[model samples]
Target chain A: MTQLRKALRPSTKALPEYTRGHNRSLVLQTLYRDGRRSRADIARETGLTRVTVSALVAELIAEGLLVELGQREETRPGKPATLLDLDRSAFVIVGLDLSEHSVFTGALLDLDGAISTRVEVELAGSTGDEALAKVVDLAEQLVAAATAPVLGIGVGSPGVVDLGGVVLSAPNLGWNGLPLQALLAERFGVPVVVANDANAAILAEHSFGGAASDAMLVKIGHGVGAGLLLGGTPLFGSRFAAGEIGHVVVGTDGGAVCACGKRGCLETWLSIPNLHARLDRPENADARERDVVLREAGERLGIALAPVVGALDLGEVILSGPTDLLDGALASATVETLRNRTMAEFHGSVTLRMTALGPDIVLRGAAVMVLSSRLGVS
Target chain B: MTQLRKALRPSTKALPEYTRGHNRSLVLQTLYRDGRRSRADIARETGLTRVTVSALVAELIAEGLLVELGQREETRPGKPATLLDLDRSAFVIVGLDLSEHSVFTGALLDLDGAISTRVEVELAGSTGDEALAKVVDLAEQLVAAATAPVLGIGVGSPGVVDLGGVVLSAPNLGWNGLPLQALLAERFGVPVVVANDANAAILAEHSFGGAASDAMLVKIGHGVGAGLLLGGTPLFGSRFAAGEIGHVVVGTDGGAVCACGKRGCLETWLSIPNLHARLDRPENADARERDVVLREAGERLGIALAPVVGALDLGEVILSGPTDLLDGALASATVETLRNRTMAEFHGSVTLRMTALGPDIVLRGAAVMVLSSRLGVS
Candidate 1:
């Protein structure tokens, strides 16, 4: 009888703390997306009472997270309203990128997601605790370089990260169930957040790159993967593997073997190493042959993503990788194949393009993580 | 300059009215999921104050939506707590299913999602306004047959339905931009909700069929389409065509042409008519040959769904169609193909099965719609 009753518990309940936290996020998100606004404007826009807005804004300003920017320009207003905005330069955020093969990059970023200082350390094929140490060292360097109080440290690693920032596995880094965030927080005495590199890349795209809320960012680097942002929130899935599309078999006809032992996985067709290998083969010497190789890889990618775009009705697909490889032939072919494979009316409009943030996507995405977690603004 | 300011507007805001509606739904959802509970238990579970719970419960009971069900029998208690629950049978919901090729089904369902009475009308090749009339007639009959006061009417039609209950298109029924919900509401003088049949089917599976919160229901009768329930909320895409997967080309080897002018679409491989046609052919005379056809179709379905499963990390996929056709060979083949196509670790645990609701899925789903919208129960 007790078991039966226990089985009937609701999954989520709205506690007072939760509601307060939600409202804080709402306030910060409004300011982040809409720029500066007066307290009265915020109250009207968010449907909160003027008193509540005043209290929240006062608390934010006291915490050094918000700043008063004098009065708003008046046209037809009875009285001038004091404008409030995020203190973009009040604190520095330490961002770490552990996704590169030969280097680990770290940066100090402002609240506006602009890099203030950058540093790097050679990985030299380090693994396990060695790689972990390098990450900590790089983060420390970035922290030391910050001009203002450090807000938080955010790391974007190559693996399946849980809600607690535990990297379940990253075969290349020899990490499994590593408590990276807790270790960093203990060292830095600040809040720390960690996520998969692709996940972080999509956040960077969403927060600073002007991507749609309902979009997918396919990171095609050392190994292929994707990150999804649906309805302005990232989908972490039931097991934190929502965008693990690299190992999905894309080709019906047999192809080169994948590291996971799958013969025709999406990674086998679309990964950087594999794409370059196929293009550089002796048989594919001419420009037309190279185009065919890229087009075929793009078609395979389209085949894999068509169902996802159809199922979720995604608004766009952004490729975060080398423009020399993904732009032109491969990108156009992906769009063409997507148009053919999916329902034309519903999915034909799904935009496919390269990321504009360049190589610093993961670094910027890490800053977004820190901003969203420590300040409730993404 | 005006356009620039408008562009910066946040997509959503936490309005007080929205919060009140959310809290109301949270209270009802708690009772719906956890069965009978006292106002104190409700307050503790929802983190609302005792006064708020008492006021909400009083209002709900006064509205005939909830009922006081005597005191709890406690061994050690100073005062016995009064238990409360939904008035499950106080009002009836009229649910209509218009996906059948030859008939339209309607039912009078209690708040518990149990069918109290059922009715049907032959479509008989009707199209346009004639088909719409049959749907209205069916709904009218179900409303008339209700044993209690009507809560609302819900219609599960085949088409792209907008949030405004407009059917954007349904070629077989010749419906385009039809305000079916409004027309029905005008005639019946009740709140009406309309959605795609597949969408409704997924709701039934989530609310009463014991499906996971992150699951997909694939409807494969006259067409092959899917409905997604992510985090217990149905995903109606930007254009309300999130599950429009019928025209997605599933076969890379290129088999039969589809009605959508595509080759080897999911409809061609997995639709009931297509499957039956292939199985009944002279080439598939033997049972073993029939199994091959079923397995091939299932493989094609798996091919199309592998990316979706990988991208979303869905916990399960439920096939809502004829069990005799989808069970055994086809179902097992789908599971096997999915295993082969997706990553071994992340997607290996995804369950694939036939829905236990049998043929009344859409009818029950429509009831769920009414339950959710009118009383915020589902």
Candidate 2:
């Protein structure tokens, strides 16, 4: 038994080199999750040596980002251990969600993924310059309320967004070729990441909500859009217009015209505005009548989505936007249509769920985008 | 100076741990391309030590894959070094291109990616089981003729191919839910890989042909399909039907019905057979008249592909399969239509070129698929 143990052990005491950065990340994650722990306890939990753990802990403490919390009780040990934890008031991030009709801005963050502070402001105008001013003004308010240093800003818009923070096109917003990232960066004097609103919402759900696994989040509002998560990473197509399922033609004829100059688009009949328009007859002008229109719209939405659902074999489909408009009967009708159109083999196999982040999903996802890009954590 | 030289020398005599496998691959690739080299020559070119080169060469030779040639010219103050080269007869791979009309089988290759043998058989019936039997029989004949050990078999088909080797739906071939991989594997008692034909062609182009950069290859033969290569890896959508651009509607009305139960599909207007039917009068049929019809068909094909050409912003579009049908006039029309419909900014920016792989592209691609799968290179 002694010989076998000796044989199994490596001859040298030197640690493998590639695992250094990985071990550092693990230690940081552990400290973030557990608050504070003694060096010996960290070693046992992470399967790292005391010497390695002590070195990392000492380096972090020296950086002023983490601190030692004195000694802990010695339990069946020769010496007491020093406890360490992340300094919670280290940094904060700003999140912004820009839409055609509204602009939402907020800030809430922690090293271990917790909300510390949040603020939102309604936009009086939807012009490009006006929207930008509102975003900066709200960010300032959030910054004033924050106790931690502001790290960076993350903004989510509705359009074909490139990695460089440019909005190539946003039909609903009547914008074209806007350098959104450069504007935000110039305003705040910090790193800014701009992504599509639907893409950001999916990221939020994937990171913190029920649809956290490999899934697809479809945002149904003024225009239909989708964000795809494959293998835990967002998939951006060749031209960044990958998730524009709204333009896909589901009906051959008699479908409403779309803003894209195309007829019979999925967005034409399924969008909230279109549904409301269809239901605003003289006889059905009340809220109760509007509810009936919303339900019918959901049924049409499911029919349009059946091919996509069958094609991707996605595990979950998450919807977000105007909970009042997407109520129980509407959602149930959408599910029923989806069930009827999809292959029987996959019937009852996929889950259709609602967003958990409420109206703040896009904002939270924007914050998450900043946190992930700046700190290398998701 | 002596002390400095000693200090600069690596502490460990073995290859650097940082990129050992990568360096080994580089050496192997060099030999695969240049045929043979001496240890001193390899050291001079690869920046590797003579001792390290000698160790790898010895291991490869011992594995009965590499051969040691006679002594080469000596430039050092010592004896001449032996040259090493890969054994050309090490192994062989079978590539099969299964289409709706015919089946093409070929061997590619060892040392040189050249076809060793090839055979084409017309299918009496287009059933999955019948096609599988024909493939198995031909593969056995090739295996029996080969002097070297067979590595594996690769088949490229048209449809939604799963990683599990099932053909989900091949409408053109009247196939659905066919276990192609298992059928071939059980019959031949060898490893088999099934891939989408368009995807296979794209891989071939990316690895060996001129469309090596980030490009999209649209194979327009009996059917219209697209293969996208982004960052050198095939982009399979969440549901694996990502590049199904054939079904995208190009015409609003007065278009022929597609086999997929759709009207005015891009495929109905763009396919070779449909194009020929539209132009050729059966009463006035002749070889010269057939050429005219093919040329006219190419013109229509260009019109159908114009939107796709604009949407993806592809650097190059490669057309493969039956070049005789897609001659210069057809190509020019495609270029002309693409120029007119695409965004003005990208006008004359995209290059439309015929496939460099000839008629045997799909066959060659199938062989490459087998090689990559077995070697785990892709």
Identify the leading candidate in terms of lDDT. 1
DockQ (C-alpha) of model 1? 0.29
Kindly report which residue stretches of model 1 are placed more than 4 angstroms away from their true locations once superposed: A1-19, A72-79, B1-19
TM-score of chain A as modeled in candidate 1: 0.91
Residue A316's lDDT within candidate 1 is 92
Give every collision pair in model 1. none
Q: Against the true structure, what is every candidate's RMSD?
A: 6.1, 8.6
Candidate 2 lDDT by residue in tens digits, A121-152: 78665556666577778777876776666666
- TM-score of candidate 1 chain B vs. the reference: 0.93
Q: What TM-score do all the candidates reach, one by one?
A: 0.93, 0.70
Error of 1 at A296 (Å): 1.3
True contacts kept of 1: 0.46
